[model samples]
Target: MQTIDMTEFQSIDLRIGTIVRAEDFAKTKKPAYKIWVDLGDLGIKKSSAQITFHYRPEELIGKQVLCVCNFAPKQIADFMSEVLVTGFSDIEGHIVLATGDKPIPNGAKLH
Candidate 1:
C-alpha cells in the first residue's frame, strides 16, 4: 500500500463537526443528502453524502462526524460541497460514518 509522509498526512485537515441540517438531494444521478455541518470556528459548511442506505435526513441532525475540511469545494449537480464527511464502507459496501465515541467540541482536530 502507498504511504504518505507525516507532512503529507498533516496537510489533510480532518476535524469533527456536528450535523446541523440534512435534506434530500434530488438533482443528482445517485441518491444523496445535502447536509450542513457546524464546524465551530470554521463556520457551517455544506456537503453531499451518498449515505442513504444507512441514514435518514432527520437522523443525521446533531450527529458529530469526522470530516476532511481542507479539500477544495466540489460541485455536485447543483450543490457546492465544501467538506467531505468521512466514512468507512461496511461489508456490504454501504458507508458508515466515522465519528467520535462521545460528544466533543466542534472543530476538534483529529491528531
Candidate 2:
C-alpha cells in the first residue's frame, strides 16, 4: 500500500473546525452542499461536499469536523472551495464526516 512518511503526513494541515453554515449546492451537477466552517484564528473557510445522502444543512451547523486547511483553493461550479471537510464513506456509500467525539476548540491542530 502507498504510505507517506511523518513529514509528508505532517505537511497536511488538518485541523478541527465547526460548521458555521451549510446549504444545498444547486449549481453543481451532483448533489452536494456548500459548507462554511469556522476555523478560529484562521477564520471561516468554505467547501463543497457530496455528503447529502446522510447529512442535512441544519443538522451540520455547530458540528465540529476535521479539515485539510492548506490545500489550494478549488472552484467547483460557482463556489470557491477553500478547505477540505474530511470524512469517510459509509456502508451504503454515503459520507460520514471525520469529527472528534468531544467538542474541541476551533483551529486546533490534529496531531
Candidate 3:
C-alpha cells in the first residue's frame, strides 16, 4: 500500500451527512439510486449511489453516511452527482455503506 503524509489525508474533505431522499436511477447502465444528502451548512447535495444490491430506496432515508464532499461533480447518465457516498465492497462484491455507529449531526467532519 502507498503511504501518504497527514496533509494528503487532510486534503480529502470527508464528512457525514444524512440521506434525506432516495430514488431508483433507471437511466444508468448499472442499477443505482439517486440520493440527496442533507449536509447541514453545506446544504443538500445530490449523488448517484450503486447500493441497490444491498439497500432499497425507502430504507436509505434518514441513514447517516460518510461522503467525499470535495470531489468535482460527475455526470453519470443524466444525473449530476455532487458528493460521493462512500462505501466498501463486501465479500460478494456488493457495497455496504460506511456509516457512523451512532447518530451524529449532519456535515460532521471525519477527524
The alpha-carbon lDDT assigned to residue 19 of candidate 3 equals 98
Sorting all predicted structures by lDDT, with the top scorer first, yields 1, 3, 2
Estimate TM-scores for all models: 0.98, 0.97, 0.98
Q: Give the TM-score of candidate 2.
A: 0.97
lDDT scores for all predictions?
Answer: 0.98, 0.97, 0.97
In Å, residue 105's CA in model 2 sits off its true spot by 0.6
Candidate 2 or 1, higher TM-score: 1
lDDT of 3 by residue, 4-110 (tens): 99999999999999999999999999899999999999999999999999999999999999999999999999999999999999999999999999999999999
- Each prediction's total of clashing residue pairs, residues at least 3 apart in sequence or on different chains, is 0, 0, 0
Query: How large is the C-alpha RMSD of every model relative to the true structure?
Result: 0.5, 0.6, 0.5
Off by over 4 Å in 1: none
Of the two candidates 2 and 3, the one with more favorable TM-score, higher being better, is 3
Model 3, position 44: C-alpha lDDT score? 99
Candidate 1: clashing pairs of residues: none
Per-residue accuracy of model 2 over 21-111 as CA lDDT, tens digit each: 9999999998999999999999999999999998999999999999999999999998999999999988888899999999899999999
